[model samples]
Target: MFKKTSIAFAVFLTIQVHSAQANAQDQTADIQAQAQAETEAETKTENNSIEKIAVYGVRQRLEKAGMLSDSIMKTEVISAELMQHKNAVNLTEAINNTPGVRVSNECSMCGVKRIMLNGLRGEQTTILVDGLPVHAMIAGYYAVDAIPTTGLDRIEIARGAGASLIAPEAIGGTINIITKTAIENSATVDASIGENGNRKVGILGTGITDDGRTRATLIAQYDNRDQVDEDNNWVNEAPNQDNRTFSLRVSHDLTDNDNVIVRYANIQSEVFGGPMLGNTFADGTATSVAKVLSSFDDIESDMLFEGGDVRNNFIGKAWETTEWVNTQRDELSLSWLRALNDDWNMTLSASYSDHTQDSFYEGFSYYAEDTMWYVDARFNYFLNESHLLTFGVDKRSEEMRSHSSGETNPAYVSDAFDYDVLGLYLQDTWQTTDALEINMALRYDHVQADFIDTSKPGKEIDQYILAPRIDMSYSHNEYWISRLSAGKGYRAPLSFFETDHGVLDAYLGFEIDVDKLERSRSVTYALSFDGEQLSMTSSVAWTQVDNLAMLTKTKKTDETDGGVPLLTQLDETATVTTADIALGYAITDNLTLNVTAERFIYDTAFKSSYAIAPVEKRLTFYADWDINGWDLFTNLVWIGARDLSDYGYDGYNQIDSNGIVVASSKKSTHAPSYWTLDFKLSKAITDNIDLYIGVNNLFNYTQANEGESPLFYDLDGGYDVAYIWGPLRGREAYTGIQATF
Candidate 1:
């Protein structure tokens, strides 16, 4: 499972120097200062509408930047100074330090490096590069890492559902990676070397032509590391891996009022980790056992002598074997923007992507392919000096074909899928007075699917989703404000769930009987103090997803309670309540302290008809403290887990009535809490060069489950299962030198 996605990403770079490469970028610095001044000057005239800060394009572009996922929060930006010190390979990692935001790696010790945005899973969130959807066909748990963060302006994160402007079912959130404009001719190259022989390199170049109106950006990155799982427990806490990624973006301002942009990117990555090799027996001789671990269901393992075990205790490997899992993604998209006037703007965007995977589990290999394309249009009208309106229409289609056949498993199948979606929505913002402002939005989404498989019933699913949001802010003074925001957003299942043929048999979330998808409604309240040198925001968000498709907690035979447990897609009502609060203080203008906490609760009974505590909580502390012009930041993250296993026998709702082998559904309720610390220091050695060092997982902590594969496997005989996720590398530290020339 070791390949690299970070290689070819470096080749796509356009080395043809453009006039925009001149990096004495006092212009960007001046523009930022002017934007800040303008915001301050209009802060009172706009009736305390400071949320409009940073919309002006200075060093970057923000055309597709919308608070698509949040109503209470407008567009936000984190300075590049904040990004320079961290190991930012993707947008999720770039925004990890923002207040009330989280980019969590779900299976940190796996073959694929996938990440979850916010609290929702990967499939639940939409990954948009320069406002275009990027389809990376990665192992479900490790797909997020394939995205390249080498050439970025900044990432915009919408914490709530932003279905009003885009497609529905962004139930968790949306991450939009904006690209830098060709403001100058500049190139930045950074290389890092760290623990476990880990090494990474990032190269970014941006150039502008056409008298500074046209811009081109190219970025490439590579990451390769050795495998070192020290526990010798037969499990690689984290697999050794290789990664390569590359992308190029070109933009031309057709006129002062119209522009067109095009971008292309690709990723190739691999990983390897398997069972440990050492075993203990009664005779003190080394022994191997059969069925030691299974990553896929269609393969047979001959590690041990079958029917020869004398004790319940099992000891096998200290890293005896490894597999190679490979994944690749290619994405292309084009966008056009036209400014009708100072108050009117229109944008059209289209994208095409192909995601391919050549993943192997010893004798079994899975080769899956997916291709998708979509187009969207947005229109914006400034109602007045202090009011704005936005509306849009979007259409998208996707197709996936999978040929999964193992050497020994006769149950393999080839499947195909096709899906289409269309949506429309509108939003309005108004300043009621100098002391108050309000925003309201609504959107509708419809989708259809076609599946080509004979083993499962082919069905067409259609859905109409509605999202509404309203946020009100009242200013008590120049330094104080109180706000209340309430919004409703929904998440539609991915095409794989409705159109992947038998893919649903692999997970419980897909096992649904209804013809419609699910929806989420939320409300949040916030209070903040914005002073001359400090900004503190405290917010609480609560949401509920009615008819959320959840896995059946109690196992049964033949789908019980009208629920599908075997990766069967279903629609069940679920309430996910989260309490979040954060504070960000800019101490002495050069330093900032940020801390956040969240309490999350999930409705497990909506699908199971039985109640369980699926509670989780998180706390993060981030600080950017500077010393003598050197910028340093430290982030500490912790996740409190709960026992989420329901060992119910069978795939049905009815329990075994026979007294002899009746399998009772006993649940395990306690999983240990996990914590990680990351740190980075950036020193501007010169105006054109920077020095940085960072450590990820300062404590070198790994996610260790106690004989449970729910996080990485489909235990119900569906998808493949993998145990001992290799040694989750501990204490990754890296140092690098970056220069802009």
Candidate 2:
């Protein structure tokens, strides 16, 4: 089916190109004649008064689209105006409408969310700030929620494997947050409130010194929300959160050709969710919220066993379990840029960051800390305009410490490690003609890792890797553009914290394969069109990953109960292919619409104990209208059904206490499809103030409607709450006011 669709799309593209060319040729004569008349009229009116003509059209939209389409590496830019119009409160909400990108909320307890690209797992994507890789270790999973959208210039997103030529960790692409610079003294404030006891406040300001040699920018934000329960089953569908973030940046000019920038950021958050008040079970284990919501429940079931009339035995029954996460992060960075004559420039940047997280799930406690230092230096040479060269070197050192304390047999299990990476890279860009450009990059990295375990006498691990990439772009005409890119990327060996967040205490006795590395090779092709009133983009990416690290259940020993699960890392091979098409048109002077369709096909030879993203297709539509002082924007999104059977949890067999094996519940295999509609309206109260209101999930669509809600129980009365496949929060309405000075 996918092959046939691809062939049809190719044919359609050919026809479109031909039609565009023919139309362009036919319109050439008309345009020339119109230009001649306009010139003659303007010459005659030169001695008279001049008049301003306002043409409400797609000029601004097309200009932004053109800038993105002309790049050698295909990139999608999300402007601040769009963010405000869509009422995006954070980075997660900002990219919800983007094709090939998804904000996946995996765990229900703490509401852990990550960005998934092209249907791949969240871990495959790399998050960056100002072109620097900052999400590492524990920060890679939970810290994404703390990033506020207070002072962003724009967000650049690359969707595909190996989308970044310099950052090898970008196997699933990159999300780079670009910061806005201060142009003059200004201040802004925004406040909002929503359903479910949600509230937010933010303030941002910028200033420049009288001498114009120094500038500063600062932003602060606070957000709080209660748990969300659409089904009203005494279980929270969305966790409660209290989050705060602050950032400050300053830039100073050292000389006419040199400048320095310093920045600092702090973030803190506390999130919790699970069974609330009045949560009680038939069994004598869990009675009230205070008793059942603070500890992990043991596996106990009343379901019939393999032997007729026999029931599974339970050791320690605790039905109440609440999930909680407390995290704090601090970062400081400094950078210096200098111009060496007219043809050369140099840059140096360094940063230090510290992150700590404390979490609890059903009485299981896990704590982790990560400290990292990074430095980068680069030089750029223009080399006479047509040719450009860039050389750079970077180094990073990170230390991770993780430990778990709970009622498990191990009592205490901890892992601590340190690693360092040093890399050198060179890139060259050549313009063969006025309409064609080629870019090539090569990089080499050396890594040294040391595991600290006094009981095992740890040893040092070292490895070397090489990466290469090539990108090309051609401008066929003013209305057509084409680009192609290919690259090789790799991720370093995983630490204890990266694998499972140190959840399972059984890992204390498990073995690990430290030599394995996750790597990928990918290729992509893109085509774009920009007409007088219409624009379109289409692209396809194919990626193959080798030695993919996957967590699996290992064999049990006599000392370990058959019920206790141990995790081990395994190497596997995987492939992902994705294709997407986007189209935009100006229906009228005050109305514009955009539509996108995307499809993904993933293949992995390894069948593990975890569930991967099962979504295969997505569709998105967006429309904006503006007239007078009122503005309206709307978005519609649809997701395809997924197969739960892919994770192998259909009536599985497990051992019982009597040394007998029994079959578990026969669960459903298919997750149904769902759709949502969001709307926003705003009106200008004054030149410096505006009021806006919006509704999300206007249809109140949810997975619960299909009996696939996150709240679920096994045949034996064992509760599990993390099987979410769709929107848990049904509907939300919010209103806010913004003021600028």
Candidate 3:
């Protein structure tokens, strides 16, 4: 692995050197011209008699507040500059620092991270790239960590139902990742290494034609991390991962009023965890239960069952404790923009994605393939100088198939699904006055789904839905703004992989009985203040979801067949309420401080299948300082506690090898609160080079430190690997260097 990484780094350096040599002359001339222009501007300013206020990039807090106040709905932006300050390498690490957003791991073995918005699960959020829904179910499961931050310009977030015009399934919120547009010639490379065998490297390049009509950008990145086990149980607490990604984008002007953009991206990733022995045997065959149990002969018996008797019984079946997954994904997208006249404009876009996975989970072998296609067309018309009308039509189609084989069950096919949706929407923005604006929109959708399940009869479903939204923004004064919004949204049933991938190991098969669409209604109110030295924003929201899908397990009664479990869903209702506040103050010309606080309340009838409980309260503090040529940043986050018994995690029944209950152990009901601190420092060594160092989780805090383990056993002696609520990894220090030419 080290040799390969070295070779790749050498190639990247060679490319950068060649490009620098080619552009050296042009760069020198541009620098001289820029200095001359600056000198002339300074002279003009000195000669002028009138006084004027100067604006600087140091006042980014006020600028960001202005962006939020001017939008029709509440929106948040995460800039690339902030990501750099945090020393983030992937999308998950960057977004996790933002207020009102939570990223949690769903599986200890696979390390599948899920993004939660406004107290809702990851499945309810719609993730997009450049306003296109190319990250489908299978790919989305891993995209959060596989996507590199090398070429991102910014990220836009909107929380609520019907926040996007084209995506109707965004019951929780919408996240849009925007890429940078190349307008100049530049190249950048970054590399970092840390504890636990962590390593990362990335390169970004942008170029524009001399005619100023064509632009292009390219990015490549690689990341790897080793597994960690703190309890000395020969089981990993954190999964091992290896990821690689590449992307390219190009834009061209075909005519004076027409432009086209094309983009392509590819990702390959692998994850493994569980027993320390690895995923397979020496001969590349599946490891049997006897073979795995024999490897533990040297360990003491008491250490194996320290948690409880149920946990001990689970440990007896060693074959059901390992997991491994390998994935490959490719995406292509295109967009065309045309101006019909001064009052009318049009846009057409299309995208396609293919994802494939090969995996081994708990003595089972599962393979899957998924493909998606999407198209969109929209037109905007300016009417009477007071109103702007926008209308669009979009269609999305997806198909997924999987094959599975296990020790107790015969080889069979599962999760064969084909789904299609067509949507049409119209929106009008009316500027009633200079201080007030109103936006009203409506959308209609037709959904169709077909499923082929071997455990039960095939099923087909067809449905139609209508959604409406309205938003009003009023400027009370120069420094104050108030906004109100209400909307309705619906979501179609998703594939099995999107719901719970771990259930595949425990269940023989699944049945589809969903008869109604999952629907939601939401309302939000926000107030903001943007001043010279202080800025503040606050919001409150409520959402109610009906026909929420929930899963249930059923056991086979026949003796001839193994007593395997089958899974299905039931319709239910859930409600969520949230309140958030953020404040920023410029303490000095070179220092800034910020604080954010949020609270969430949930009323639901079903427990999370992944054993994840919502956090009730959270607070974060941030500080940035710049002195001389050095920059420093610090962050602190506090997470509140929850009642575990309320989520059905009270205790587990002790069972012997013959499945006989003997005793029970009560578990801790109340989880304690915890906090973490991070710090980073960077300085520019030259005009084109920078050096940085950082420490994450400075206190080396983890759940194990609090005597709480993520592994838990149930009444039936089946273990759950997703009982997590806090950080699993400890402190780590890293240093890196960046170069630009």
Candidate 4:
């Protein structure tokens, strides 16, 4: 998307800046504390919920809101108590502190990020908002960006195939984001400004009107800064970028047992590559962001020259991505609490979602729109006070299109492509005893995608996929808990197959479809111990992929196919394995800390892509303190992940004499350890106004690239580290004031 697309575009073109900030502080320990609060009362006759029994999703886990993770089913919840008090920008970074989870940021360029649940890659994790599928088929691997942290009321994480309640393909795990619910009347407004010209504002209000219940929230955030590519490199250190996000939501209790909810959100922005800031002659090559910044011992002189030079080269190569993301979601829930009955109840739910995406890179643009529907019903009957039989069924349908210039797929090549899918599933959750419980589920899907190449139109893909899953949990009374689970999942082929991207961070180098890929096995084990003000949790999980699919240029059917190479997903590469672990702590009523580490070992034979991410590890620190009308917190992270690959192909940069493309195995370079730290402070000045102040990248450390001068040196500044390693955003200061009625 370009700057001229909206008034925001004009602001982007005129302003050139960057940001160097780490994510929010870890607060899961706080979550463990809130979960201890038992639900007691209900709303006044007006509308309120009294804290009653706080059993989480246990009794009905994997039953309501598509919650796959619960006792007997294996899941975790981080509610509003944990979300509201902290400064969280995205889910990826926030979930990093969750046990057995990792925010594997694949590329540091142009929104290259994804959340890895239980060691599974972005493609393996399914994201749901209020029981509805938000990421379907082609669009996967978005954690924080798609959701505004402020709007979320709670987060539910389930490990393994999500059984049948969700789609059957949640082989690794599932994370469901629950939005705020209905209420009599409530209003909240948040506004803050931080270091590096950073500013953020949010407003949320909900109430029961004459007709129905409604809740709404709006968030506006901004960050701008300067950076020096330390190396005498051509790439930028921290390219300049700006962003804005807006969201709205409403829910209503229509009838005795019927309810409905709706949500809408949009995020738009412009990003200038710091690593892409140098001169290039068509071929991709360069120094790094770290190198450019390191070259100047004399900060003043270096800035004058480095600033102008980078701008000239950068603007010339400024590849603009003008994009707009719009989503419309609807959910309907019906529950039969009881009718002249004792311990029997049934709940049925249906949801639908529509997504519209349009992106323009350079002068070429790509657009795609997709719609999906989901239906689920569950019946629960109590055998006794200590046991219950819960069972259900689920189904979904999806239709999508990729369009440009006007036609479909490679046909208009510049046009759009379309496809459709239908799926069905079933599952059950059983409470064996007060101490033991079990959950089981299964699902099947049939989908067909088409490429409308008006020219040489030909059928490329058609497939039906099946998936199944099961899980169990044991609670040693109320203080100790354990869970075990397993499941199967798969990804069918699509028409746009092995295609191309207009962005640099586009991994895989081609389109996604090669051959129909399916994963047949899953394993997950987790445990938790809770104390009055302290809590602990640990988990281990693994997955195996069968009949994996990948594209290989070296083994192409016809090297002379003119680079439009023949591609297919095969059964040869199969069985990829992965595992993960985590821990958390609370020191005092005012302070909390958490730590989580994860590992991914790709089974070489399967070749499903993630191998390039290396043995990744993350260590985070958090501390929140309130004093004299002020709220302060500090956050830091130390990350280490290494790739074992070594590049050997020679003269690979040169095209054939006839301009034909030649290829070699994708190579990943070494990425050393990097660390970042940040801190924030907020003050309440009056009944109607408040203030926010903070510093990001407190160390001013960044991956070094480019050069402020010839004498300086920056080893960490290169595009190489972007995918494998990351540098600090650099030190920045910001301040802002907010008002309320």
TM of each candidate vs. truth: 0.75, 0.83, 0.85, 0.70
lDDT of 1 by residue, 1-741 (tens): 101111001111100000000001111122112222112122323333442221223213222222121243432354454566566755555665354454433222344433333344445566667666765322233445555567777665555666225645666566677776555567889888888878878898977653555677888988777665444443444566678988888877665455678898887876654443243422233233233233234333333211212011223232223344567778899888766754566779998888876654433345678788889888777666555677888888787776644213333323455677788888776656656667778887777755555534665467676778776766688666666656777644434322221222332222333344556766666666655555555556666666554333334534332333332344545555556666566666666776777776555533142111222677877777877868878888777765444311122111122212212322233456778788888888865687888888877665342333221212232212222221245677888888877
- lDDT, residue 625, candidate 1: 80
Q: Where does model 1 exceed 4 Å of error?
A: 1-78, 96-118, 136-142, 275-299, 302-324, 383-387, 406-415, 455-458, 494-514, 550-565, 569-572, 606-615, 641-669, 673-675, 703-727
lDDT of 4 by residue, 401-424 (tens): 665432322312322234445566
Clashing residue pairs, backbone N/CA/C < 3 A, model 3? none
> Which is better, 2 or 4, measured by lDDT?
2
Candidate 1 — what's its lDDT? 0.53
In candidate 3, where is summed lDDT lowest over 10 consecutive residues?
14-23
What is candidate 4's CA lDDT for residue 363? 24
Candidates ranked by TM-score:
3, 2, 1, 4
lDDT digits (tens) for residues 386-501 of candidate 3? 56677889999999887766423443325678888999988876667766767788999998777765553544568889999988777798777777889999876656555665
TM-score of the candidate numbered 2?
A: 0.83
Among all windows of 10 consecutive residues in model 2, the one with the lowest summed lDDT is 23-32
Please list the residue runs of candidate 3 whose C-alpha ends up more than 4 Å from where it truly belongs after superposition: 1-71, 277-319, 406-413, 454-460, 556-570, 606-610, 650-665
